[model samples]
Target chain A: MRLIITTMAIIVAIWLIPFVLSDESGLKFGWPYSVFFTLATLFGGFLFYLLRMPPMGPFTSSRRAIGSVVLVFLVSIGIITLLANVSPQFAFEGAATAGATAEERGKAVFNDPKVGCFLCHTVQGAGGTRGPDLTHIATVAANRKPGMSAQDYLKESLENPGAYVVPSFDNIMPPVAKALSPEAFSDLMTYLKALK
Target chain B: MPPDVPLINDRLVLWVVSELHLLFAAFVLGSPIFIVISEILGVRTRDARFERLARETMRIVAISYSLTALFGAAMTFVLVARYQTLSNFIFQRFYPIFGLYATFIVVETILMYAYLYSWDALERRKSLHISIGVALNVVGTLVMFLMNGVGSFMLTPPSSPDRARLWELVNNATWTGLNLHRFIANIAFGGFMVALFAAFMYLTSRKEEDSAFYDWMGYIGNFIGVAALIALPVAGYIYTKEIFAYNATISTLLMADKLAWFFVIQGTMVGLLFLGAGYYMWLSIQRIKGGPRFRTYFRGVFWVALIGLIIWLVPQNFLPSLTTKPAGPIGEVAIPEKAIFLGLMPAKGLAVSAIILVTAFLYLLYRQAIATGTMTWGRIDTKAQLTLTFLPAMAVYTMTFMGAVRESARGEWHIFQFMADKSAESYLTPLGYAATVSGLITVIFFLLVSGIFWLGFKVGH
Candidate 1:
């Protein structure tokens, strides 16, 4: 059982990591189901491994704990049924509320159709993990640079995502001001100021 | 062609298309529930006979799944054809969630192949396989939640949403209620379907013991059906509450005078079905020599289910319109109060009747399970029992993670689209409707499926 789970999990992890990373979404099939399939395949491929080993508990029948079986069955069925009937709007609201926050709200400004600079930079643990972490730039710079304020440092980072590449990170931040109208640049700057 | 004929044709086309999508979703959504229940039943009673029940349910779902996928494909086309504006917005606004769905689609396809072939592999690790099935059902459910996030975003667009941060997506607010609602609905849908299948088998079987088998299975199915039916009201309330929380105006659209009446009618008919199922289970129990000897127990269930139905079916209110509007900046919208929620439920006077109805259904199930003699999975052949267990579990966990990913990443859609100057409407809203209409279609189509299954199996009777 351990082998089956381990082998299958590894294979699934390989697929999942890439599927999630870099975010190039190809319309793929169900991953959870595929993981079991992988486990099943490996189980078949390694059938000799099990047969050769001593059996556990005399290879007991697949019977298991059954108390509350009926109740569980009914509950499961009822839950699925309710889900099937309601509108999509309801589902989103429930999931959203469970995970909402202020940092997220401030971060959302980057994804705002109007001023979306946070998309490239890290702010308050939100946005692309691609950029340098900017969660406490003010405090850090106040300590590190001795005299430079947080606002000046952040401004330099935004107009130029590359100016000071944090050690070991890529120096690939494009100069966004070149892409945006002066107004857009200002709006993004204003949104970022509110974040501090 | 006459002008109205085209309009009528349009309605018919929409209905047919809708049925196809929903029917497919039903099978996709319903399969794992059937599998899990069967697995649970087989393991507990030391009876593999329950395994066969699970297989039959899956096979039926498999047949429908093909059609479901077909209609799913069609629904995508329908979006482009019928609801282009909405479709455009969905793609634009909900690109992140959609992207995740796209990735999972590949996973689902891979899993389907494994499901088709894993019988051999599972035979080797039968218990593990079963666990995987449990997990698969979870994944199936997670997929729905992720889809729901994208779908729900349409009707209730998040306020001042950060379209890019995945975390913001997590905070969308509607995902939990929608997920819970869908989860419950699938269970009910699956239970009804299994019962429907068993009923077909009983109606047509030639073997003397076949009646016994079908009767027992149907009885169990009926219990699930009735229980699920009872749970529907509470589920519906949660759903309405979520909608009210999101936007009272949309809730009003959903609960317009005529639509409310439609729901009342729907509730009444389903209530009648519950009573019918309970009655049938009661009769099936009579076939057993040592059935529960309590007529009052049976009578209680009937009257209670009836009363519950009548009470629930009562127009949205009984007292005068004492329900006042909520005072606030959002005051144009009627705030649904806690008192109003109470008033909407069946009157307390009928609570006893509802209890009896639920009790009767439970009694019928208890008696039937006792008589079946097949509740023990251990009694069935080990080799046969090993097939198809646990594949869905992998699906469940991964899909859940995906949903978690989607849930977490959902905020990123806003973050991405805002920078891109794209409205979430370009992707979120239309795709959601397409999914919605498709889900409804899947339901209608599956009912048609039950009818077909009935006809095919009935001939042998």
Candidate 2:
């Protein structure tokens, strides 16, 4: 019962302090309200628990400890979820808005959840480490294997990732030849080519 | 296209959560390295002390593993929910790798439990148990290396075309160097934490035998920490060189520009670490039945360390940047030309190296002093135990500040040159704010870690 009350008090303080004490007030008072309120709520809870509970403390009861754990976890998750969902400005939809040119469209495909190119390959240096970095794929694709041209190497590798595993990398990439249509594949290739 | 959400600084949110996650991750990754070492030492020497210590260490590791998972899951949620586009890009690129990483986690979890629970049942099959220890270490090290590769890619990404090849990105310019640095650092951190636990046990232990046992454990823990500490600077140097090679601008930003003060702060903490270790070792020499013959030798070491620290902490720049207005009067002092070398890279690097070498030499002397049988085990006093506590605290603080420096070095970009952090909430956080947040997070991290350690004490007892 005390744990529930203490947690509620802290939560209320978190919300109330921010609403009541504006930024100007915080600056004028020469105190960080967030830090002060947080510390106060914590100290208050500690004092409440110590004065009300027995000498040994609340944690002596396994039930109380477990309750506090569950309460804290739920409260933390609740706040984090609220913050994330409520604040859309924190999210980026740049790629979604910028897919126009062939290269840009290819980037979209590379970043697309459906195409899953990024699942194995990095475009322009920021992707998966499971496969090799393809930042300079256009430069090295032709020379990676003998008797294989750049296009041939890319095609063969996409169709059969295990055929020519890079020396240091594990051959864990599943064949994606069936996954990408020729047009989408071409678009990805365009993105890859523009990477240089 | 920023999402139409209301105000709340997501960058600050990410920074705090990620820092917390990293602290736990360090302990989780670091503890196993020493656990395996302690186990192997026991098996070879047939020393029951080593075996007991290893078991105790495993208990703590088991408790911390859950916290690590909890924080890791939280960090992932922040990435996916708060920065959806950025998370989507990374996830799309490495979903399969993520799958593999998850599989490793499951295997690692089972191995960790088996290693902890089957201690007595598999007592007779010692070889099999040892093999499990080795497997646990292997998987743990592999996980660190894999993550290091990903982290290195963010700082020094491959050029566009090379980024196409997943293997190339996996083996990015900074990957090997970072792996090596982190590997050494993990061992050192693990050893420090073990020493901290042993010190705590020694302080609270009522029985003479228990105190003696923990005193010995604390000594060995510090020993491993010093051993790893000796190699840390060299690995760090190599990592920095690789960063320089990959991108001069980013390296410059870290070492000489806006982030330079963080390095100075890191150097001060590192200098304190050396001094703390030296003081602890000097105090520990009292355990010798005969008086410490190396008192004069360690005095000289203290001098070297102090001098090195003074040189290392010398501010590289006293003035604010040309673009920014000075914060205070001290920021108006123009740096003298000839005295600039004192704050330069070579001077700072050499000073740090000297400090490390001096610390290492003191440790070697301690080992020799102990080997002569003149030193009896377990006479470490409360003061020495207090020093052990300070060492890990300083290390945690240093790591948090350095983490800030590293993340902030990229300026406004999330992926260095490749992608910009274009969200409405994205901005380069001022150093004052960053440092304040980092300090707060460090305190919270240490408190939580201490809580975990205390909880483990309840379980172990």
Candidate 3:
């Protein structure tokens, strides 16, 4: 009973001290202090828990050691879970609010799941890398075939991705002509043109 | 790339959790192979010690098998929650295989339980028990091969008009090499764990007879480990060669980009592994009475490993723009230009092969010394005994480091040519930071493994 109370008190104290210390005018406060405090508390709790547990030597420190390990393990994993749960919002906001210009709308469309452009294509090196990087796709399209303009090349690619498979790449691209509206497709071309 | 969701550092989570999963999985897969071998040895030779050893080993295997399942479940959850992009891609294409993988897991668990529990019950029916062990190993190996197929397909995916084709996805260029490499590595890992168990028993045993038995057991376990260790690098070479053939650009980034230094660190760790194993073998020579007579040959073995260490660690080249300077005629000279050639793949490959061969040969000598009755048993130095314990730790460390290298090779892509890693955490960590993180994870792994061994011991008691 004493151990549980003491551990809880220590954990509560650990949680409170950082906020209290940061409130003081004299000290420069940042996330580092909280991170440090959290880590120290975890370790302090782990050590105390292990110290209090019955000994199982050669093996030593009993099952509590595994508890400590799991505590650390879960905390690291929890942080990842938190981050993964949060990031998609930022990515969505950044894309959705890209603006009303042709190039901006094209980017929004490119990133849009409905259009599914970024599912296989890379744009300015930020999207899926399954398809060819479109960082300079505009230039490549111009000289890709004799007598073909860049606009026509881009049009062909959007409608028929299998027409020309890049060397070392599999022709796994599904045709996306029906997935995008004609205006969105034109905007996507503008975005590709500005990529260079 | 983003939905209206909170962000997480998926890469770190995946790396750490996947490594934990791999460690347990390796032990689970590796343990069965040797358990079957030990069972056969016992049945054939009618030795009680081997039978007890085999039974005791199964205890560890059973516990590890449970942990592997637990971690596998956790890893699946992590994939679903955190690595949705890659997870979705895999599941979308290989849904049937995922079902098959789960089925294998269930069947494997049943077989493993039966194998573990039936040892004493079917003692008189030795062949029947042995067959159960073989069935268990087959299921376990199938699990490993199936999992490796998924991982390797990501590294060298096959392109097709139909993206969801099971056969094409699973049979990618790198799959064969990965299966072979992982198969050998699993044996090496299992051997080390058995040796570790024996070492612990040797150290803790009160009776001289028990100690002697464990000492011999440790020797046999370590010998199996080293033999499999010898084949591991060759299998690794095949895997890397396939990756290079799949795409030169991806290969260049893995070998020479920001990740290059991690390979250097991997080489250093491998050198330490060779040296540690060789040194342990050299020390084990003390158990043999006229083991001293082979002292000259032991020294040769030591020198071969030391030289191999030096050659393997030589950097292939300086940073791209940094010019190499000629050595001075006097003191404090730079490493000669000619010396850098030794660091290249072919040269380092030869050096490592020579080291393994020499160490293996020295093992033969140790066996020969024991056979002629020139070697005394149960006479290892305390420190030398500690090195035997250290051998397994080194093996685990080498596996973790090399595993890190293999994943880092994927570099900014979840599936090399098929999918991109566009998560916020897709950036590659610097080599030093990554190595430190890996080292920390290795320590955690050792602690966890030690805990498992302890639990196994307690259960047996």
TM-score of each: 0.52, 0.68, 0.69
Best by TM-score: 3
Q: What is the lDDT of residue B73 in candidate 2?
A: 88
Cα lDDT of all candidates, in order? 0.47, 0.68, 0.68
Question: Where does candidate 2 stray beyond 4 Å?
Answer: A1-196, B1-8, B161-163, B322-332, B459-461
Candidate 2: C-alpha lDDT: 0.68
Candidate 2 docking class = incorrect
Best by lDDT: 2
Candidate 1 Cα lDDT to native: 0.47
**For all candidates listed, what's the TM-score of chain B alone?**
0.70, 0.93, 0.92
- The window of 10 residues in a row where model 2 chain B has the poorest summed lDDT is B322-331
State the displacement of the C-alpha of residue B102, model 2, in Å, after optimal TM-score superposition. 1.3
Q: Point out the higher-scoring one by lDDT: 2 or 3.
A: 2
Q: After superposition, how far is residue A30 of candidate 2 from its true place, in Å?
A: 30
Best of the two (1, 3) by TM-score: 3
On residues A144-173, what C-alpha lDDT tens digit does candidate 3 reach at each position?
888999888888888898887888888987
